[model samples]
Target: FASVVTAAGFSPNAHDPALFVHLSARGRTLLLLYVDDMIITGDDSEYIAFVKARLNEQFLMSDLGPLCYFLGIVVSSTSDGFSISQEKYIQDILARAALSDERTPMELNVNLRASDGELLSDPTRYRHLVGSLVYLAVTRPDISYPVHILSQFVSAPTSVHYSHLHVLRYLRGTISHRLFFPRSSSLQLQAYSDATWASDPSDRCSLSAYCAFLGGSLISWKTKKQTAVSRSSAEAELRAMALLTAEVTWLRWLLEDFGVSVTTPTTLLFDSTGAIDIARDPMKHELTKHIGVDASYVRAAMQDHVIALQYVPSELQLADFFTKARTRAHHRFHLSKLSVVDPP
Candidate 1:
């Protein structure tokens, strides 16, 4: 029964022992859980009673009415839908960072150019600062590129590197930000991907970036160095697309398992027209002959209608933030595109 429901479309993982249930009804097909407790939803009261009776017979059970708190999250009923937030968690992070005061967060600025117009010298303290800023990227994706770049010098940092620590000081003023999951959007899957060519000064290796969204809300994003070196900007961009294609495939599988049906050829946004053209054209041109095997697989998938690649202008590419440094204005603009806003 579990296998059939799961295979056909049901998430037993949702009812897993980790989540506690607070409310359930047979008539409405509503179910909630926290840890081992469960609240089922449906129109049939008798079915709900039967489930309760069965559970009672199998294990000791107590019926709790309405849910105030489950696990570490607080739940409140509303007319539209439920909202979740980690208020306690937010306070704890602030207290741990010793940033209880200073209401407004400093503007995020990671581009720390030297006063003399030279690349700043690296220092050991730079690593520590970069480490802190990297963790802070959980809430501020804007600084991901600069943080990643500064991290490469951990083994040997210079004075110029220490200068980058100022971004951490900036974060000290803004640790309270949190991700908001609004109840006001349809549940649709959308994705965007971008890459920067030869952004690393030392290795000249390009960086790959991708962002995935559900109903216009930023859900997942990543910034990482490419595993293999590519010869051209087009190749790097194709590599990023392949990675994005793989992610979308996995996400589609997971969604299908949860009873969500997405149409074939899901739209994916790409900033490089060269990459888009390479993906759309199945033939191996001179420029595309050396593309990695993974990228080739992605191009094949695009041609097969597994995904559709759409061209996005450079300025509109949110993944641009993931692959390169940007000014404060551009950083804020990308954050806005991700729908992240400072707490009121």
Candidate 2:
């Protein structure tokens, strides 16, 4: 069978293969491979071990336990599914900010923003708050937008920036919030990315926002400043789509590594139709030829079957929560949509 399989052009793989068979006393099972990992499940562990032994005879391998950590996320199993977080990371940031004493979970006062009326003579306090909030955003997506906003003025933060520090302090009062990942859902990937063009008063560059989902739960996200200036809102959005596309490509490849097959045409949602059109239309005309190479590269990747792009309305775009400043109500709304909920 090995020779026959090899003759059929399916050679033994040390990493992973497109397909393999598991022969059992009762029946035979099939195994599929992505890039380097394989997902195998059966009713019988003994039979699974037999299959593993046969595969090991042909290649080198290591047996690890169930999936726990990946891409900096820490996962712990619950009766329902899994609890994921960077709680230790959050703790460290709190201590650094001199707020460890405040970690006892408590309801945050939205009124803390009123403290802006009081001026801090030392600007270092503002910088310290921004730094701590930035670190906290790793597990607390609810605070990412607020942190990004405060971080922008860290260089010469005024009483206004200091006022915003109350937002971070308020958030610090709620660090127990976390994102939960239950195992009951199907394995599907969806992504959304958006941008606010020339949002900064100093630099004209746009801000990029992206969110990725594994099934119904968000698994990854980002909100960052664009590296270059975008000539228009469309261009800013295109740049964001490009960034999201790159992330989708890497994620798909990683999923493939785990032997999980993802159908082609991975859907990526963008809020700007112009950006979507830019990604779909390969023609490099005057309006887009000047677009930064980074964005162009993302478009090219989308065209090459790396991922697919779709347009979403700005109002429905969750990525917007990451890229721009919002009022308290909208901030809570978007953060809740991302599934960053209060902890018990």
Candidate 3:
């Protein structure tokens, strides 16, 4: 199959074997292969049709027209931008599960979340809820942090049902809210990385979170707990920056394959000045020798001009939405910055 695509003039992307890029005087095209399924996209309509015909000659193929539905996401384009949602999947689970507004009581929810407490009677139910929320995180970045915290207790079991219920209610109310990508959004890549020191009382592991943006629209974000404990907030911040820098490098490579070459240095925003100093100052490494690898990786990225580090104040740090729970005002502020449209 790879040979056949290669024969059709598409060069396999080094960053991802599943992706292929075709460049010519006519235009550019990108093909992503996933087992039996493939998505072909490009700016040249004629070349797109030709590629379809060319691929069809070697193997039977069906062109699915424009991408309206794929991998559970429902896409709709408008004059303003594109809106994508897992509306069908959300509705299906809501109908089958015990999360319906009519059935679930409002008072069951608690204001503050607790990581450890009395063991849950039904651990399987907690696990299932965690799994569902994990799947939902594919389109719902707003729930990523909470879901990440809840998942840690799934194996040992702890307070969970009410937390899951709260998330379900949010999904129910914002069923129509969808991810929006504006046509006029910038093509340049920008990213945010942040970490909270000693956030987890149970293990003392720090929480690291980062989000990538394609112009104004968000393309990727993650919430994770560091495997090794950091001695200070600066160490945690550097580790988080290291993770995000690697992600940005991969994304840049992926975009280049898609024919959207990012010529300018990618912006990596963080709230930690100590991290910035550690990555920029060679002498600072003597003080941060324990985190040598992560510090060095970031420093090399800066030296090579792959990324430029900027210090955003903690209050304005958008990645804060992923590392810790926030007030309603803060949540909306970060949500809007990510270009998500909430349902009224």
Candidate 4:
């Protein structure tokens, strides 16, 4: 495949082997390959068509036309732009679980502690379900955190743990929910960084979460527990900011490879005033000394103008949804902001 793509005048992307880029004076085209399936896109429609013809000549490949479905995700084109969903995938999951008649809940509740009930007689089924849920979370960010929590007990799942699979039921009601990416959105880069201080009861580690937006549409997001324990909230928040800075830096490079130049420094919003101050100030306080190394990375990014860190009020902090559970109203607000909407 690499030889075929190279022969077709496309160079494979360094970051992703499956991606190929072709640049010419007229325009640029990107080809993404997954096994034998391929998605051809670029600024020049003619160039994209040219690549498609070349691939068809090289291999016995059929042109599926525009990308409406790939893998398990369904893409719907709209006047505004494009929307991606996994409705069919969700229904298939429900059918396999024998939960076709279940009702979807509006909110998710997760208990991270190890279950005290009897262990499942067959843990394989539980593991399989959890694995499937993890994949489904690709288009369903709302379930990311919950699925993360459930995944921890896959090896020794209990009856109590399996019961919490009600999250699947919740998916049944909102299966048509889709993520919208508007065509009019700019390429400006903006991101939100947040942390739930000492969220892990077992090790006292914080949970870090961040989401990056391109022209107000979500393109990247992550929710994971921090590696080291922090003594203070400011330190934890700084760690989260540092992680986000690294992500944004990589994303900026990726955009450049895609021929999208982001001239302005990426904006990183955080809810912690102390963390923001630490990132901006050259001198560090005694309380933050433990995180001096992590702080240095963030400071260097700021100094280089790679990222512009700003303080945001907790109420408007969008990454809050990824770090911790929120009230029903707050969850709905963040979901709306993330452009996760039900089809009309």
Candidate 5:
């Protein structure tokens, strides 16, 4: 596949090897290949068509017009831009689990402890369901936190762990929900970094979460537990900011490779004033001395103007949704901010 794309004057993207870009004086076209399936997109329709024709000539390929469906994800064009959803995928999961008629859950409840209940008779089913839900999370950022939590217990899942499957029921209600990418938004990168201090009762590890936006459309998000225990909230927040900075830096490079000039420093919003201070000031404080190299890494990025750290109040921290479960109102607000909406 690499040779084929290279022969056609397309170079593989550095950040994502599956992506190939053909740059020309007229315009640029992007070709993304996942195994045999490929998605070709570009500003020049004629160039895209030419690439499709070339691919068909080289190999047995079926050109699916306009990309309505691919790999279980459904794409719909809107007045604004595009909406991506997994409604059909969600329904198939419901049917496979025999929960098509089950009542949907409004919010996730992941307070399950390892000692909460007896182990499941068949752990395979639990693992399978959780794995499937993890895939469903590609376009469903709302369920990312819950899915991350549930995946942790895959080794020895119990009844309490299985209860996290309520997220599937929640998906049933908003099965048609889609993420909208606006056409008129800027291409500048903006990101939010947040952490929940000592979120796990089993371990003292904190939870780090971040969401990156390109031109008002969400491009990436992550929810994961921190590897090391932190002494203070500032430490946890700093670690989260470091992770966000790494992601933003990679994304900036990706945009530059796509011929998009990311002239401005990426904006990184954090709810921790102390973390921001730590990142901006080169001097080490008593609270931050014990911090690992991640703190220094973030500070250097800030110094190099790779990222601009700004303070955001806790309530407006959009990454909060990825770090932990929130109130119904707050959850809805974050979803709206990410442009994840149900079809009317």
Candidate 6:
């Protein structure tokens, strides 16, 4: 496959080996290959046709027109741009769990411990359900923190853990929820970085999360507990900013393959003025010396003009949603920003 693409004057991206690109004076062509299936798009229709023909000659290929569905995501086009959803997938999951209840999503603030309640007679179903929900999270950024929490107890799920599956109820009510990507000519990158400072009762580890956007479209997000315990809120926020910088760096390189030039430094927004001060400060002191290398890495990136740090109030921090569960009103407020539209 490598030789085939190279023979056709296409080179695989250094950041993502699965993506191949061919640039010419006529226009640019890009191929994103996932195992046997591939999606090809470019401005040069003639070059696209030639590449499809070339791939067909080597191996039989079925051309799915306009990418309506792939890997369980339903892609629907709109006048603005496109939206992707997993409505059917959510329904199937609810059926498998034999859950028919419906309601708005509530807080995932349940304080579950490993030793809390009676263990399930069979843990197999719990593992399977958690795995399915993990896949469903691909297009469902709203459920990130819930899925992240539930996945932790997969090995030894208890009856108490079952009560937290109310997130599925919310899914049933808002099945048509989709992630919309609007068309834009701007080739810019920005991200929101946030952290929950030592929230876990079991361990003192903080939670770090970030959301990355290209132009006006959200591209990536994550919610995960930090590997090590953070001593202060500032430390946790700095770690998160460093983490987002790494993602933004990779995204910038990936955009270059699509012929998108990110001329300005990527904007990184966070609520921590302390972290921002620590990142911008040149001198190191005894108080911050224990922050490890993450904070220093962010400062270096700033020096290179790869990223610019800015402050945002806590209420507007979108990544805050992924860092921890919030009240019903706060949940809706944050969800509204990341999820552009909802089911009518």
Candidate 3 stretches with Cα past 4 Å from truth are: 57-60, 98-124, 158-165
In model 6, the clashing pairs are none
Tens-digit lDDT track for model 2 on 1-344?
45533433333544434555444465444455555455455445666676567667766766665656544456677776666666665565556565423221222322223234445678787787678667666777766766766676676666765644555455456656778766785688889998988876566778898999888788789888888898889898887887888788878876664456887767888879887777666674355777746556776776687777777888889888776556657767776678776544
Candidate 2 TM-score versus the reference? 0.67
Per-residue error (Å), model 5, residue 256: 1.0
In terms of lDDT, the poorest run of 10 residues in model 3 is 102-111
Top candidate by TM-score = 6
Which TM-score value belongs to model 6?
A: 0.95
For candidate 5, lDDT tens digit of each residue in 1-344? Answer: 67877887888888998899988777889998899988888877777777777777889988778889989899998787888998888887778655543222334445667787889999998988888888888998888888888888999998877876778877776778899888988888999999989888888899999999998899999998999998889889999998998999999888987888987788999999988887777675545777747778887887788999888898898998897767767777888999998776
TM-score per model over all chains: 0.67, 0.67, 0.89, 0.93, 0.94, 0.95
Clashes of 6: 0
How well is each residue in 227-252 modelled by candidate 6, as lDDT tens digits?
A: 88888899999888888999999998
Q: Which 10-residue span in candidate 2 carries the lowest summed lDDT?
A: 103-112
Give residue 207's error in model 1 in angstroms.
0.5
- Show model 4 residue runs off by greater than 4 Å: 98-110, 285-287
Which digits, one per residue and each the tens of the lDDT, describe model 4 over residues 158-185? Answer: 9988887767877876788889898999
Comparing 2 and 4 on TM-score, the stronger one: 4
lDDT of 1 by residue, 81-135 (tens): 4433344534443444443333222324334323323444544345555665566
| lDDT of candidate 3 at residue 338, scale 0 to 100 | 76
Kindly give the stretch of ten consecutive residues in candidate 4 with the minimal lDDT sum. Answer: 100-109
Clashes of each: 30, 4, 0, 0, 0, 0
Q: How far is 128's C-alpha from truth in model 5 (Å)?
A: 1.4
Runs of candidate 2 exceeding 4 Å displacement: 1-76, 86-129, 152-160, 292-295
Predictions: Cα RMSD each: 6.9, 8.6, 3.4, 2.1, 2.1, 1.8
